[model samples]
Target: MWYYTLNGQQAGPVSQAELAQMLNGSLPSDTLVWKEGMADWLPAQDVDAFRNIEATPPSQTNGSNPYAAPNSIVDENIKLSGTDEIPATPIPLDIGFCISKSWKTTIACFGAIFLTWFVYILITSIVGGVLSTIGTAIDGPVAVAPITEGMTQQAPFLPSHNQSINQQTGTGAIIAGILNNIFTMFLGLGLTLIGLNLLRGKDTNLGQLFGQSGTKLFRLIGASILYGLMVGLGLVFFIVPGIYLGMRFMFYQTVIVDKDLGVIDSLKYSSSLTRDNKWRLFFLFIINCFIVLAGALALIVGLIWALPVAWLTLLVAYLYLHDGERSLAA
Candidate 1:
């Protein structure tokens, strides 16, 4: 049996094979490992049992270690020394595995997610209703005569009833649209915080999601706006550039929400985190799009299931990338 010091505390009594599995790829190569036969603890790679096992450099992107058993790999919940942070470790993500994890997480957190959306909708509805009532009170009633059959047959070319409704609702619709975007921004931030905490294996609830996001609202907004502008500008110049930059900056929001970073710092951090993994991300994005589309095809009700699944998958990707980046830094 062998024991290892992970983060700081001693953990294990793991068998030689278990230790070898970890040393081969799971635990960092330089992790301190000790066994009964050793005089002192030494790095895993330096131990005789693991001397032949070459450590995979953190920067490697070949996806060679995809088949490692989860039980043998370092626990996803493992924290860094002196901190509660989950260290990033990039691993090959199977499409099915990603989908499955997303589905499970979405199911577990659905209640909180439902509450978050419900409140958002309620607030937006109240705001819109108030604006609508005020608009009606100021504008007075609008009356339109019903078109008779003979009149309709003679003037079939005229604008239809739907157009009338659209015309009457124009200002209110614009106001509602603005309100929806603003409210969605806040809702996104709150949900993001909730998801991040869950990913880090911390306990979080619906209330805490919104509560913690209050102080960070402006920062979130700034990061979102900056990311949008960059993507929009890239799109304006060229289609390819737009797609590339969009993928590159996709993690900006995740970084900002997770680390409370400023717009520029988050952008730079996400850019580096995603380096050499853009294609993987692209593949994941396409798969998610298809998954969502399939859900939408099912009478549009499946989006309830699909939306959360997509969100969870995205968080997994972010964590993996962030872990890899941290490992490289280490």
Candidate 2:
């Protein structure tokens, strides 16, 4: 059985002869073709089996070649914005290919990725612990008054020492939570940047965790805020819309980091990129959930491996959807 890429979607399980018949010398030689046991997709021209196939001459195809490449104009200098060449109609996602590829990458770079995650966790934990301690100290322990048989229950409208303490504690907790989230977001952006570099086979090190800065950092934060508010609002109104928007804007971070798109532009691009592929994305999410759960089951330490694999799998999906198999590392 063989499979081929047609307009950025995987198409087949067709027999070799059937694929040949379908190609009929109509598709471009650069179209990617693959079959089980092959390591990765290769241009049809590079495969031995397709060399003998000849293009159907323009004169023979009744004035129009059905397989002619789209007329979309692509900027040759831009490395990542291949969207111009992609069809606006929905594209198919290969979930199995994503997971398998992500697993292989995880194995290949386990040491660096694991160490990066460990440092992130360590910093987050220490800061969180310090914040909790400060909050506790600020909201001293509540004193309980002994109840007398005749003592009336405290009036609902009356303010008491306990209530004041509770209010102060709540305020402190909220502040702590906000600070923690911002810090984590900063670290996460850097971590994701590292993942992208790793995906491209670029060298990565610990310092990359703090690689983001200036206008790009601000844009990422702005996009994140908008994304969170929109998703939260959807979740508040109804659970379904939240899930829908969540999947729609899933690639915002990647777009911001990889393409240097502005906040609103990143959101728009993510929506465009994810259009018509939500179901497959959802399935991939579920599969990653299982992978994480399995890792959790293998002693809590398994998270060291599970978490990165899950994250890398999503990144793999992003690359696949953004540029098809071409952007993926073999």
Best by TM-score: 2
Poorest lDDT segment (10 consecutive residues) of candidate 2: 57-66
Model 1 clash pairs are 88-323, 88-324, 89-323
Weakest 10 consecutive residues, lDDT, candidate 1?
61-70
lDDT scores of the candidates, listed in order: 0.64, 0.73
Clash tally, candidates in order: 3, 0
lDDT for each residue of candidate 2 in 23-102, tens digit (9 for 90 to 100): 56667666677764567777676788876777333221123223333333422322123223223344588898888888
Provide C-alpha RMSD values for all models, in order. Answer: 12.2, 9.7
User: Would you estimate the TM-scores of all the predictions?
Assistant: 0.60, 0.67
lDDT (0-100) at residue 107 of candidate 2? 95
